[model samples]
Target chain A: MLSVAEIINLLNSIPVGYKSPEDNCFNAANQMYIPEYKKLGVITVANELQDNLPEADENDLFCDVPGCQIAFENSASYQAHFYNVHRYLCSVCRRCLPTAHLLCLHILECHDSYFIIRAKRGDAMYSCFLGECKVKLPTPKQRREHCINKHKFPANYRFEQLCGKPYKRHTKKPSKSVEANEIVDDMDVVADIPNMK
Target chain B: MEVDPDEPKTSPSTSRSPTQHIRDRNRQVAQQHREEQRAKTIDTVRFGLGEVQEEVEELDELSEQDINGLITRITRRKHASAEEMHKLSEAFLQSMDNIKLFFEAPGALQVIVKEIIGLDSGCQVGALECLCNLSLGEAPVCEKIIHQGGRNLVQCLDSPDERLKRTSLWIIANTISTSPKAAQTVVQMNIVPKLFYIYLDDSGEKNIANEFREDAAVCLQILVMGKNRAARQEDITFIKDNMIKKCRNSVAAEYHLKIIFHADIVNPRNEFNIEQTHHLMDFILGNLYTTPDFGSIANRLRIVYAIRVLSNMVQCVPTTTIDAMRQQLRGVWETHLEVLLNKVFDFGEDLLSLEVVYLIRNLIHDKSPQPLPCQLDRLEVPNIDYEKLLPQEWK
Candidate 1:
């Protein structure tokens, strides 16, 4: 147990963190290591060494997959869950992963993420990058091949970011003034930005 | 709430087929029956007079002499049965006004407090149990219990007996939950520091005995829970929307929420202010005593609970809350950040680690604060990829 004096020393050692950072993405200027953090580092090392404590009985909690009949303790729950749940199941190849946490990683690295559509039914099912398109392929390259050969969808339309649900593109409204201007060769300043296209 | 720390590891004695054991069971039941009857009589005499249903309302109806007499009669007994005390305290809770009257009675509180500190662990635990039961939500009674030398409940925290420590911590938590005033009173007693001191007294492995520390965290939660603007916002909404749903036409929820949180709705007995978040931080950090868990799993749960309480405090406080808290102490954010990320890396899918991340995010980025949600909602990720959403710069 940390003694009163040691605890005081520890507290005194750690600088109160930066109150705020102005930079958006991430500012490494805000991150710093101190002696207190090293103490925490020691704690983590000890945590790893002492990590073998028996787990609490979680047999009662079922997998979060909707309609899943698997309680955590069910013999096949862990082993069969990949195929049991679509989130863990690679839709085209039918390969399964163990956990939802890993499923995203697996799909991103292995499967066809091009048609990245989420079918939120019993378990999360990742589809080909061209959302709502019927062509389900084992890999992104396969989906791209199928899209090129079979579908007339735009090349950019067939592509989507694979991670963190990529980005949701809401419908864009054509402005009435812009529509009238479109009768002419409308030059918008916003369109001048290369990425705006 | 789920862990029944009091439950025996082994089942109570049971045997069928043996006549001797059957007789022993019968005898024990009969003895218990006699005690219950005695407890019932004592309860009836003190509060059952002048219409039993209104006995709670009419507790002060007992002459001072009668109250004193009842106190003397109950105190003189060498061993007060815990069941009987539970029964009496349960009855006392019904008319909390009478509980105040009972405690305020010439010498009754002193007797109970004395017995609580007495050498007999059973008596001490029993008194704490009765007190905890009596003051569960009754603010006035709880206030009286704490101010009337009941703050001495801290003594029980130091006792060698685990049962006594548990019950005493529970009683302190119960009173703290009574209202913001009770919370302020308990915290002002430097309860957070005192508890940490006792918790680390063993000075061995940094394991916080869950039986004790979990409740200690709970007490800290109470100290901070209803004190913040969000809690008050939620409180006002709850009181108006749910507390007096039927009485909406008659009594405004705002009036009631203010009245209840401020003190008694009708009779604002004592002005009770919620303990400030900065003040709590001072206690938590200044007296922040801890034993190194050196990494025990049980200790991990304790850390999770402790961080949860801290996160709750963070959620309750405003952005300026951290600024004020930082004036008093530094390193809460970074210290927690290290511990939190470490746990997250060590134990993926840890809900507590997720909360700590948010707290760190809030502290690090100074994000525009959102309205605090209910406690359970805090555990879930805003989206499944919340982990991926974390800054890539994070180690």
Candidate 2:
């Protein structure tokens, strides 16, 4: 279980979203627990929200990131170097997230509407967790087939249904109120949970 | 009608007869009629002059009243409706004197600019048109418009209404055309990118009319083509960085290349760095190699622009840069030169042939160590029919 101080710290770091900070932390943790949501893919978000990556100079082709002494003669090589050497990308939204923890935070803050709509539909969501593959299937059989045929995942790879019930249960809560008393109530509930991670 | 003294001697042969008496009486009657006719003509002239003088005085008073009314209407705190503003703009367009009077009014430009920013799109279009006419006045008037509301005019370039955008571009074009100082003032406002975006509206939707694009292109050309060195440099840099760099491969490449060519004519010596020179060489060479459909006038024009840009690059770009580019693009250059020579000798487009000839001349004059792809000495000059090439009036 998270200590009170740790929960308070997590609450302070929640970024732009409609949910309370505690709820955001809870949702981010839940998203992190799902394996398929951790895979990175092409960015499909707004350019404004994309990681502020520096562009390679047309002639010089040098990385402008601080403390990096890397350079290349061509743009393609420079792009490849940057892609491989730096930055973690959010798998669900394909946004570049700086760290694993921020990726978790981004998932909950940015994809709240997606999760809510899915939970409202009460449908099972299956996605390929393999390298940069964003294929989502409706059933375990199709997912397993996709993983085996497309990604070359071993047949014995265990496929679990990604989170559907947790979002559905949370959907019933009244999300409009962010009163202090309600947050304390949330804190109490969070404290009661045995496995915080 | 008066009897001459010599008439009596000529008539001495004829005795004082009844015929002479009748002639004298008849002549006196004719003289009396003539006097009456002259008196009538004088009276008519005096009457017409009086009417014309009165009408002129009335017209002067009416025009003065009309100008004052227009100035008052424009300077009002409350914005004029679209119809009223349109009528006022039309009235101002009738004469430069009215435009002068309207602008000379206290706070008239400020009020019009306010209406442009604060009114509905329809009204804003009218106000913009009014400003467009106002900018068509003397240089001082254009300077006043730029000093008063240049930023608002630039903002109107982004208006959703096509007329509003076009009128804004027209105003800017007029302002820049008046004097270099006015053009520099407008350039300092950072309007190049806005005008360029309007020119190259890449959005698949045809929201921007061709006329608006033409006006925007004119404004951009004037801004870059001005003799003001600082303003031209600012505008050229904006076009190179924001427009040309972003849309080098798009369909608008021809237009961007034309702007660069025009800007290059007034370019300061050795302003382009080595990298920029190389980039330009590659771009110009690439366009030169790309064959266009000769049947399409638009495509032919694109080639003309490309060749002209290549000529500018040859002339203005540093010698070392040119040498390096020549070495790197030798094969492409050879093909391009062959195509240009063929166009000159065979295609018979007077303008295109002339530009190619100029490009060849520039190449020869550069005098690099490497030999030109084609032999100028062996090449036969095509006999161009000057009469056929001349314009109809010239012919």
Candidate 3:
């Protein structure tokens, strides 16, 4: 319920010209924002990129998984499919497990170091990895004991070190010649861990 | 009372006997029969025809003179039955000639407006529909309605009947869409907030239908997007104050953004000034990450809407203005770019991924005179692994 005069005032209050930037990312010598390809110092390569994906259908919901091409009639059906078939797909490692129980085990055994880091950062990391289980613990020791008793993890398994490493399932050929720094190495779990308490 | 031996005896507190039950049932049946006969008689008198189906056919075949006659009848007999008014309204909707005749007849607009204001909710809905159809006539017809019955039209928006409210909104939308003058006149009546309330108000006895809210949205769009600068200014101000500043409802904000998006799309000459555009961009970018429950369906839709609005705004503005805004709001842009890039690979939802891709496309392939450095550096085409990024099955 604004008065006409108030509305006019509000519209007038909007500044017309842009304010001067506190910190500018552009060089003062270059007035134009030049593209990287067109820069004088940069070397150019003619790479022909092809869009190989099919156009999306508005009426159907397509699964977003890399190799899954399943289409669902509605979000409900899609959600059901996601929970039934893809819920056990690990977010960190992308490994598909046979059951929620096995997925929980895999996460604990393979991603223990990541969980420890998250716990030290004060995140709520002690919740059961099984989607249906709502049990949460405040301390790492209590979480370990609960998992052993409830989820049947090995009683003597090492929880302080990362036991498994993620491997690249699919690799893309570099459009340009690869640089030395562009190559990614496997995670060095031992280098990351200090003295284990 | 004394009971005879031949008659079946019943206790005072017990249920009625079979004989009494049968007698009562007979009376109820006879009462139903009487009510049905009365209704049939009323229908016959209302249409002045034996059957309603026949009357509808006759209405369709109405000539110009017949249409005039209908208007004259409405003018003389202000208390026309709902069925008669409905038939006339439907006839007007079917033929443009009837609508022309409606405006050609003297005092036709006033008569209908009076009917809308004076009649019961049933008759008001019919009259409002007729007025709505008539508003779709030539520019003068819409103008005349705005000058003559504009208040009544706005009043109909406050009616309790959902259909009446819906038809009234449809009529206003039609009127405003006719011409800028008509739109400005309707805006002067200060009905924009009422439309916003209808669309955004959640406290109601029953859930308002989505169709009704959609009609309100369309009306708001027409007003804000119309060539009438005054109307656009007022509507945008109301949206800024209510939907943007308070941030009451995310869904409503989405609708408001949609109105702006459509305005940008239809009027590509940059209807929004720099300041308004800056405010909108900030609001949209802020909401992109601030959804209360991040991964729900509704929030996902809101994100899609935000992306579309950003894309359209970027396209509508000039290159220099974009460069200036980019310099002024570099941090906001950088954060949103990161969010958009992340959403592109969020494998849980395909629709969201597609919209993010479109926004990114707009950013990189913008029609600027020179490619923005931020866009060039952020995209990093050579670094992205296509096989790992997109679906493997597609390749």
Candidate 4:
């Protein structure tokens, strides 16, 4: 059902003389008239206004995730989508954000997602990092920090650099330091210089 | 060949039934008899010199029918077996007189040398030994044998079998020693490293390996000493840096010093590291008495070259540089001078008399701050058993 404000906003967008009795489809509560359509009352004018309003852009109405592109086909559908998909109810906008908000939050909160070592299995996903490393975030930045601190990957940005293969991704880990004896002996040609010392 | 009673009878009068069985049994018996005859003929044919010579003449003078029969007989003798091949090469060497005639027989000896080297059998050693003796005796023909498929000898140097490599080194050394001109072809082939590796491999004290090392060192020493200055420079540096120093990596220090006794000590100007030259001298003086006199010529000449070069260098280099040379040679002068002096006075009695007199004359004539006199207290004269000594004034 259209809210009172949405109905009024739709009517205000049109010129005064555009509606007629035959143009009315939905029976609206409020009506207005101009000289061109005096016979048309609230139902005709409201339906004409509803039909004249431009369609909402698909991207603007839908959340960014793959399956939610047509979540808000109607006001009731939008409400149900927010309630069911996002489980979020926005008090100020009078909009329920459910699964759609879940996706938006996933994207916003974890910038480090790009660096997350993920293995996509059909519709499901799993983290490939070894050992008790179950953590998820929306963006690559947060996920990268999470990987470095939690997973013992190299904390440096170089470790996070892409390996240029999608299947074999990076979870940044620190390289071990050269052994003391090896530094002194096998690396004589490389480390013996005064600068290296 | 006594007939066995068990032999199947194939006569038409006997056994009409199972004729196929009887025929099969007869064929097996005939085949066994033929095999025994072949083994016997291979054993009896003499490959010795007079016999082989007669055979060669026969080969040359035979009627076409006789030649066919001779080929058929030799074909029956399998040269593939180790015992057969060894005996055959021994026979070939015994028939060394006939080998000379085959030199002109288009690839005869080359084929034999190649076959010897090519086979899995151990006849290569005997075959090479025969070639070594022949080359040493007949200098003119060594090049032909070596040039015609003698390169298989070098390939033997890289063989994983140490014995094969050792024998190859000996044959190659003997081949080069037979004629100095052969060194050009041998060096062009870059065989210097292979020879050095075998000379340095200490895995075997086996007589063959030891002999190979000694003979090769001696031959390389002489070849490097050839009067060609460019060859001398390249060859000497090659021996010092590549062969002598590389041996240190594989050989015991003592054995390293032992092989160092073989390095050629030709024109030693400023080419070698002065310190290395001193170290080499010390090695020579250490082995002067201990090393056998026959193979020690290269070591002896190396020492003399060091002494002569040090002597000559003082006159050429500035006074400041002379101090460095002296510092480098301090090890030799301190440690081994007395032993070298003894060898000079003793075994070199006959050889050094005229050279020493000439050296003394040059010493008196060529004076540049008079190079330090060979210190007397550091010298010891060993007994000169084989060499004749000069008179007191001449000494």
lDDT of each model, Cα atoms only? 0.40, 0.50, 0.51, 0.39
Provide the global lDDT of candidate 1 against the true structure: 0.40
Worst 10 residues of 4 chain B by lDDT: B385-394
Native contact fraction (fnat) of model 3: 0.00
Candidate 3 per-residue lDDT, tens place, A1-197, comes to: 23344333332332222111111211221122111111000000100000122232442456797867677533333543454346666677665543455457556645667765555565655665333346766544566677556544345434332122333245566444432222122222222211110
- The prediction achieving the highest TM-score against the true structure is 2
Residue pairs in candidate 2 whose N, alpha carbon or C atoms collide under 3 angstroms: none
List the candidate 4 regions with Cα displacement exceeding 4 Å: A1-197, B1-84, B116-119, B123-130, B133-137, B202-210, B228-233, B243-269, B284-350, B353-366, B369-395
- Superposed on all Cα atoms, model 3 deviates from the true structure by an RMSD in Å of 31.5
Candidate 1 local lDDT, A1-197, one digit each (tens)? 23344333433332223221122222221132101100000000111121232232432325564444445432222322323234445453344433343345445544433422222122233344322233445444455456444432234431322222222277357687754433122111110101100
For candidate 4, what is the DockQ-based docking class? Answer: incorrect
Query: Candidate 3, residues B169-199: lDDT per residue as tens digits?
Result: 7778777777677777777656677777777
DockQ of each: 0.01, 0.01, 0.01, 0.00
Instruction: Provide the interface RMSD of candidate 4 in angstroms, 1 decimal place.
Output: 59.9
lDDT of 3 at A91: 71
TM-score of 1: 0.31
Write out fnat for all predictions, comma-separated.
0.01, 0.00, 0.00, 0.00
lDDT of 4 by residue, B189-285 (tens): 4466556555665665445213455545544543453334113345445556753354322333333432332233322233545555545434434
Cα-based lDDT at residue B148, candidate 4 = 51
